[model samples]
Target chain A: MPDAGPPGRRPRAAPAGRAASLRRQLFFWLLPVAGVALFVSALADYLVARDAASQAHDQGLLDAATTYAERVQLSPQGVPRDMPAVAQRMLLAEPDDRVFFRLVDANGIVAAGGAGLPDDLPDGSAEAPAFFDLGEGQQRLRGVAMRFEAGGRPFRLAVATTTRKRDRLMAEVLLGMAVPEALVFMMTGLLLAFGIRRGLAPIAPLRREIARRSHSDLDPLDMAPVPEEIRPVVAEINDLFARLDRALRAQRDFVADAAHQLRTPVAGLLAQVEAAERAAAARPLGAAELAGVAATARRLSRLVAQLLALARAEPGAPLPMEDLDLAEVVREGAEEWLPRAFAHDVDIQFDLARTPLTGSRIALREMLANLVDNAMRHGGPGGRIRIGCHPADGEARIVVEDAGPGIAPGDRERVLERFCRLPGAHPDGSGLGLAIVRAVVARHGGDIRLGESALGGLAVDIRLPAPAP
Target chain B: MRDARLLLIEDDQALADGLSRSLRQDGCQVAAAVTAAEAKALVGSRAFDVIVLDLGLPDGDGREVLAHLQQLGKDTPVLVLSARDGLDERVGLLDLGADDYVVKPAAVDEIRARVRAMLRRRRARTGQTVTLGRLTLDPQARRAYVDAEPLTLTARELAALEFLAARADRIVTKDDLLAGLYGGDRDVSENAVEKLISRIRARVEPAGVQLRVVRGLGYYLQTGDA
Candidate 1:
């Protein structure tokens, strides 16, 4: 009965078009992280080296300011006596820089340099030479202003220079340190990308292996060359394929069995029709002969119909589930089969309680219909068939009893297989009736038991579990 | 387009043979293909009025052929024959451009009627009417009249009359009427169709159309004047 998959469930196989590519995923995540790390460390290196380089340049400016102030000979009135251009030239040794120096008395009047500089420059505290950055944008400058005892008056000597050299040195240090690491980082990036691709090379064959397979190929994949990490997934996939294969084989077997079961009836119907045709050709067919041919044809029709029901109710086939009353299904089935029962001269009774169960309505009805058909066929003439349904202790129960010849106790289970019939069973039985009933019962997670009927014949009892609320 | 041409795509040789023979009897020219490749080749090479397809083909799932047909933008009707009792496959195949579907182990008469119905739809003409004797029925409008007097009937009763009237004077079997009345894949019992015919027969009796039963064969619809 588990041929179509457990009613309403098929094993979950990973779907197509979602093939996971580890190479691309790894590269996408790794490259950005590496780039960010390189940029951060390079920025840190640039900041530290630039601070060291700025200190050396500020010290050089301080030395030049001190030497230049020493050369200024000021009279006792705190005014410069002589301003030599050679001393200033010696101080401004680097000609690329625009340098300015100012010696001013405590009154803050520039004595020997340009007065365009701000007048509110802080009188640095009397300790060591003070260094500060003046005006940062388009002409960046660093200034060191100090107070020196010249001409017995506290004379403030200030030296300012454009930071052209320091800026160049900062770039040099950053480029010197960061460029090599950036190159190495890029190389490592390339290596990592290549490694990822090489690491995922096994998947190409795995994909090709799966792709190259025929649609019906259900064999397990060869595990030899699979990567260790992906082998487990392959194993799981192969296992899923194995389970699906079993279900498929069971379905194929059911079809094959169905076909084999139909072969005899089809051949019989064909032979009967052909014989009738030949007999009619020779002499007009008699009523008795026509009746015989019609009887076979009708049986053939019944067999095919029952076979279809059996396949539909296949225990493994996943028909959808719905909330339905077992009592209602029984009532409907009784109504549907009432005419057939009448033709077979059987009286049927209904004792239905409002029993609810979760199952495929079609499957359940087919089960009940098969039971009724079997009862009608085997119950013989002037027999009574009793049908009952009720909920008992969380399970729904269905019982059909007839006053015909009951199956022997040992033969009960054997009669549930396809094309099985008791030795003295009704000649018209296709043997698919009980088989379909068993399949349907199994699919609904129910149990079917055969017992002696209180009606002096066979009693078929079934119990199906009610779905959770 | 002169006559209905059908392509029967089935892996089961016996079913293919049986169905093709029966369809030919119903005045159709059937071309049988036993594999997916063969079916695809035939479908590509020739235009069929209707294609009877089985989903469980040996070479591949028949849905591939359905996709191929769709990709080619051919609107030829396809009726999928499937052994799968699953509802998903049925709904999926239908959604994938199969016009209709039938579960396997189907009656041959039912398959033929489905093909016939599909072909009729392909050649549909609006406002067409059918008349036999005093009985005139417009199937599209679901209306019937007798000698210029209107006859009111239920949907099922009118449908049964339309099917029988289409094959007038010919013996249409019970299975034929069942297939034609409820469609190919509907799981209706023979008793229902029998009861429906009796009810229609009563309604049509006074309309001058006779629904006669031939024992062991089926009912024959003809004019009472005949």
Candidate 2:
């Protein structure tokens, strides 16, 4: 399932203040980037320095080799002759860079050049040129030998210079090019880290704001002064809080109203009994007084009972949820209500799907009971009632239908309100059954709707969440 | 006449006045308190046979009065009266030791019946058991026997059976059944209790004990041998 969510993702709801979080985020994001940049810069500098040093070595060798090839001339016998001392002066004008020169004949002998040439060197003519390094103690020379034709004969010329001196010069040039880059790399990384930390400093205030709240505080978050990047999430969280606050308030009010309403009947009864006892002690009670007191008290008891049942359907109230066979629940609820229906001449029948569901079995029954109760109260005598449950797709559906006075389309929703007994309906009801049913349905995360029944009475269709395997 | 001392704790003046007149005619010395505080004062000051305590009072709750009365060690049976019929409130007061309870707008007779039941319960713990039809109950023994054979009943089962037997043949809704069974600490649905009843019926009906459930109203244990 996509692993629930990204394991290291930031929480969906970030606090309003982003300073501290931003600072942390800056540290999180910029540290690696700065490190990468520093590494890349260092690599580029190293590569460039290595290439420059190699080029310097090759160029210096080529320069010395070119001087020897250009100055040495071949005699009639193919012997290479050195230039006059004047030409050598011009060539050796740059004294720090020492140069060596040699010329050899076909016999591989030093015909005219200096004794620096190695006798066993490999042979080559005109177009072929080669470079080799010669080591003498701690000193090394890079030599380039090339063959040339003069006066109809072949002659070879070789030039050599100390590689150590070349390398030292190349090293100085490379260091000059690399020093600034390395310093800049280090500085940039440190600066980036500091900038990231500074940028993310606001998040700490946001975290504090969130951590300071109590669970009961559902007020909207104070989003002012939050960074623009984080405002949307804060707004969404605050909106959720606002909604939750309203829902909680409604629930509290509902309970309070229920408690307040139900207490009236019980209180009335107490008051009446006190009156009756005192009246009997002082003088004999009249028939009217006795009947009035007795009838009201009975109604009070019935009302209290109904109110209590409705309250039990409230959220967080105990409705022992169990894995139940839906068909069985319907059957049992039907059987229990059968006698009452029979007394009222209401024919109650059931057609069930036998689908097992997960819910408070009691709540399911109460929901059924209320439906049956409503049918009896409004459907009047001789009304026929039908109960059915069926499994469709991935959900279970339960329907209760009656063959009498179905509710009007407009009033169907209204009747679910507490104490909203229909106008001109039977007075015996406590006016909370449907409300209780709705509450129970809501608690079970089910949906309930009233419509015209097949029997021409009310039909309550409830769909509950599919049971887990 | 006027020898029975009746303590009246009610918040409503009109209802209180009417009840005072009715109880006077019923032959009792009536002391009416307007609030729970007043009721407390009355309880501290005088003794009465029955205390009709209202659950909703101006200064304090009627359940508080019931608790205080219980703390006093006085055996005065209290009948809690409240306009609210939520099972929790009724069960709470009852659990707190109020002997009986009646919802508001009650007929004086229901008040008298509850009061009488409490008085009767207080006078003797011997008649704890109740019998209706083929069902036999031993309230003190906390046992029920059907057809002379002992039927094992849990405390709740016994209370349900007892409640049904007490009002034998009359309709008792699921809400009242729950209130009478679990009281205030646990808020159980009528359907859950009905299931319990169903299970109880499954257990008790095998022995020819008939516990019939009325669809909309509640269950009834008929007073017939069959």
Candidate 3:
């Protein structure tokens, strides 16, 4: 299996809270829009209401002035005759409302009797009647002022009404417009929140469904019910699962096939032992004859043992993982096989590095054992064997070389296959030693290469990945 | 003369008969059973001096016999013979009270040697020092005396010598020695082992005991005149 990118250093996830998040985005864009619209509408509503109230009050004042102008027979001075009667007629008309009027000669004088009017009016200026409150809290009055040129003299007229009436009308107009707008804004915000949450609801179920799955189940989730926007993510998940399931199935089959194939030879060895036993029992055995039967038994026994060892070294073998000291394992393995090398007059040299391997110690040791055994077995008698380990390519490297007759370049890969032995090899071997070495190395995810050694024999180099952080 | 009754439990008939003949020639009364069930029945019916048990049977595992014998507290020595040489399998058989174990494809003589060793261990009631030729060893005392002189040896060396002496004159391979000594892990180096042997030889060979190295095979301990 390939190493997944260094675990536990995964990237942090982004925020997934949709409502508050969406509201924040909307607030930035919509708050300014809502504020500008509210400001413009409020200004327009105030202007229209104020202008209409002033215009209606001005019309009443003008009518009163026209009546007075007609009543006056324009006595040589152009002063009003019966001014009090005319004022009384205008002010007390219909209701007992207040009204004030003043007629001025060519000189600038007080034209209107409305409260808070300036004493001196600017010459040649046209000022329309305007409204304002007169008192503080209670008894406040709303009134209007009007200026006109009547009988060729500067004159002004003013009218007054209590603010309670004007305020009631203005309040009704604003409430009618503002209240509905506020209600619609609140309702729209609520609906937006609900819709956003509903849209993201499927993600939680998808996460839960994924979390509930067994490790062996890599089937893709059904995307038919999901939102259209999420279909791509779902499809990708299913594709990954499909690939993972296929890989796991292939690995399982490889293991099963290897186990079944290796058992047959062992069964055959058992049968042969029984046959040899009967052969010895049926007749008196001579020295050479007895030796032949015993040697055959020994050969069969060796073959069966090697077969099991080779199977154990296969990538399919269930190797338990642990932290192992490479130096210790190499030193120990070399020491264990020292006697056999000496018996064959071969000098075995060791130069091991102090590195750690994160893998199965048994499988690693078995791999090394097979390599050393192969070197001694194929390397002619009295040849020197050298073993060493060091760090290479972010992994640990193990090398075993011998001075015996090296393998041909063409035969290097073939020797790694099961039951493939070199011609003129030792008669006692099962031809599975190198094959076992290859299998063990493969199981560790390590690569092994065979080539000419410094000792003029075969050199086996193995490399395994470094321990995980 | 004591009749050494040996119970042979092998599933294969041809192998059982051949093994029985070899045992009989060695003056053992061979009681052959083809399965663990038959062996269990025969064991209940008669008393044998030693048992040669095979692991794989059509009916059940040979370890069952060992578990059964252990439960019954029967001390009759048992020598395990199986075709499976897996490290775990060997440890399991021995741990289950089998006195000895030998993987299959074994010579008749090696099997006989293992049977004799089982019988010898059983016959030696006191578990005292055993002197064969010039080599003297006391397994219980954890010491070795070569040619009447005391010698200091490592624990592994002493165990190795004991194993070699117990089955002398037979060719034991490196794998066999490894299985016997270090059953836990087989990663021991050959050179380091050779050093231990050389050390062992330096101490013992100074006297008269000879430990000869068999080329391309294993070491043999020769006690008599070279």
Candidate 4:
């Protein structure tokens, strides 16, 4: 069994600072609001309870004043009589407070009961009474004063009580409102904390899934279980993984193809060398045999150079690019091939225009060399080859045409693949020329087309995207 | 080139042995070095007609040897022999004072031709005549002679003969011939070059100078019997 090699090192996630917890954040935010609600409700309850307690106590004081007024028989000078002792005891019967009463004639003098009551009572009518508060500290009182006519004479009655009962009732009301509200506020906080944790629970499994995955695992994450809000993010990551998978596969395929291509020429060269050695042991090798060895070695060298060019031209390969004229590249490439063209008696012509573009000079040169080489190989001896470069429609167009048997439309596409040599092709041909041209075109964001040339041969038309003006 | 001295710096033992043997057969005295240290020592101690320096060496990069050559102020033409086929590396080596750059796995014939071309260019600068076997060309005076006898030739014929003689024992293509003859002028057809080559062949063939045509390729000039 083949080893899968060492497991891919786990990707180290970015270092995280002390992150804020969503649950804690929610709880902290709700605490102050809950507390404010409890305080406001307690204050309202205290206000309402105090009002009711004071109203009831004042009513008792008014009743006691009215009773004293009714029971009193006015003397000839119209002085009011004190209340009866049993009546007084009944009026003062508050367990949590002390009560007092007084009677006064029209002259504003106290005539009975407690003499220390305030004489500054508001004016009162026989049918209506007035309420007032008097004194300070332990002697503080809520009082009611009333005026009445007995035996056709007028008098004023006053009653007062301490505030202890009102205060005690208010305290009970405040505690009644605050305790339950506080309990409910605390319960709400606990529920909020629980809800926040539950809402964020799905994220943990997602993180664990990612952390546990190997680098080679480029499969997409399951989006069905992902939260709807985070689904788009996961989908984006899946898209990235798909792209990476494709690039990795392409690289692996290229490496394999290059190795396979290299093997054939190297083996041939080695065989030729061995044969030459065996022959040389018997006699000096003839020039023909020596030429055969040299040709094999040259073929191997050409293959190696082509493989390097293809690797450099592969898409996504990093290249140092510069602004250069396509015409210059075409000229240099044509010059390099002029010797071979002359050797074949091929009339090679170039009509170069200053087509400006941003590209790797080496890659462009290699691309041109391959195109010209392909033309020379197929164009045959005593044929013509035309190379042209021009700028058109915001692109740099380069065309290489040869005068030979042009490729059929159906077979043109296949020839661009690595090692796809056409039947009856030259034995020395490596079949990587068109593939390299395609890769270089693809790398430069360019398009290549094959068509029948007017010169009665195959024409390669390439258009590369130009740099923006 | 029979008396020319060459220094070959390469790490691969088999390749060095084979290349040195081929060069020696070509009548060049070759000194082989397997490391940069040896190469530097040889370059400093002896004056060579040409240095074939490999970029990859066991002791250090071949550029160190190039730097050493420059430090010694030696004007001997240095030809870079490397496995790197990248244009940038070739341009960089040339910029570093290398006279020529040839990718490895090249034929010994091509290497010899490049070395000859480099030496020819050097000799041309010194106004020396180029000789290939029985044929010798005085390029400065635009004249050719077969065994001390001046050959009557037209100016274009002499230029063509000089071009072929300068690159003797190598292929010369029609386009190269036309470009060499006329520079960037394309008005001259390839038929004209063929006619010119045939005429020159007829004129020089009687003097032991053979102008051979490699069908579907180019022409080759041979000075002596093959």
> What are the lDDT figures for the candidates, one per model?
0.77, 0.70, 0.68, 0.79
Model 4, position B149, has a per-residue lDDT of: 89
lDDT of 4 at A36: 86
Q: What TM-score do all the candidates reach, one by one?
A: 0.57, 0.58, 0.49, 0.69
| Residues A211-249, model 3: lDDT tens digits | 666677687798877788888988998999998888788
| Per-residue accuracy of model 1 over B1-226 as CA lDDT, tens digit each | 2257889998887888878877787767889998888988888899988999998899999999999898888888999988775655765787889976666666675566556555544443223465555777887777988878888999888777777765554557677887787785467887887888888888877766667654334676643221
TM-score of chain A of each: 0.75, 0.74, 0.55, 0.70
lDDT of candidate 3 vs native?
0.68
lDDT of 1 by residue, A1-469 (tens): 4234332254334654465556767997999888888889888877878778877888788778777777778767657864536445755466677776677777767776754456656566447778877787647778888888776777887778888877777767877887698797989799889998888888889977876665468899999999899889999999999988998888888888778877877788788888889899999888877677767766777787787777777765557987889977775455345544544667777777789899887788889988888877778877888888889889999999998888889999999988887788778788889998998899888999999999988899999999754
Compare the candidates by DockQ and give the number of the best one. Answer: 4
Window of ten residues with lowest summed lDDT in model 1 chain A: A2-11
Task: Give each prediction's root-mean-square deviation over alpha carbons.
Answer: 13.8, 12.3, 12.0, 8.3
* Candidate scoring better on DockQ of 2 and 3: 3
Q: What is the alpha-carbon interface RMSD for each candidate?
A: 11.8, 7.9, 8.3, 7.5
Task: Indicate whether candidate 3 or candidate 4 has the larger lDDT.
Answer: 4
Candidate DockQ scores, in order: 0.06, 0.06, 0.09, 0.15
For all candidates in order, state the fraction of native interface contacts they contain. 0.09, 0.06, 0.12, 0.16
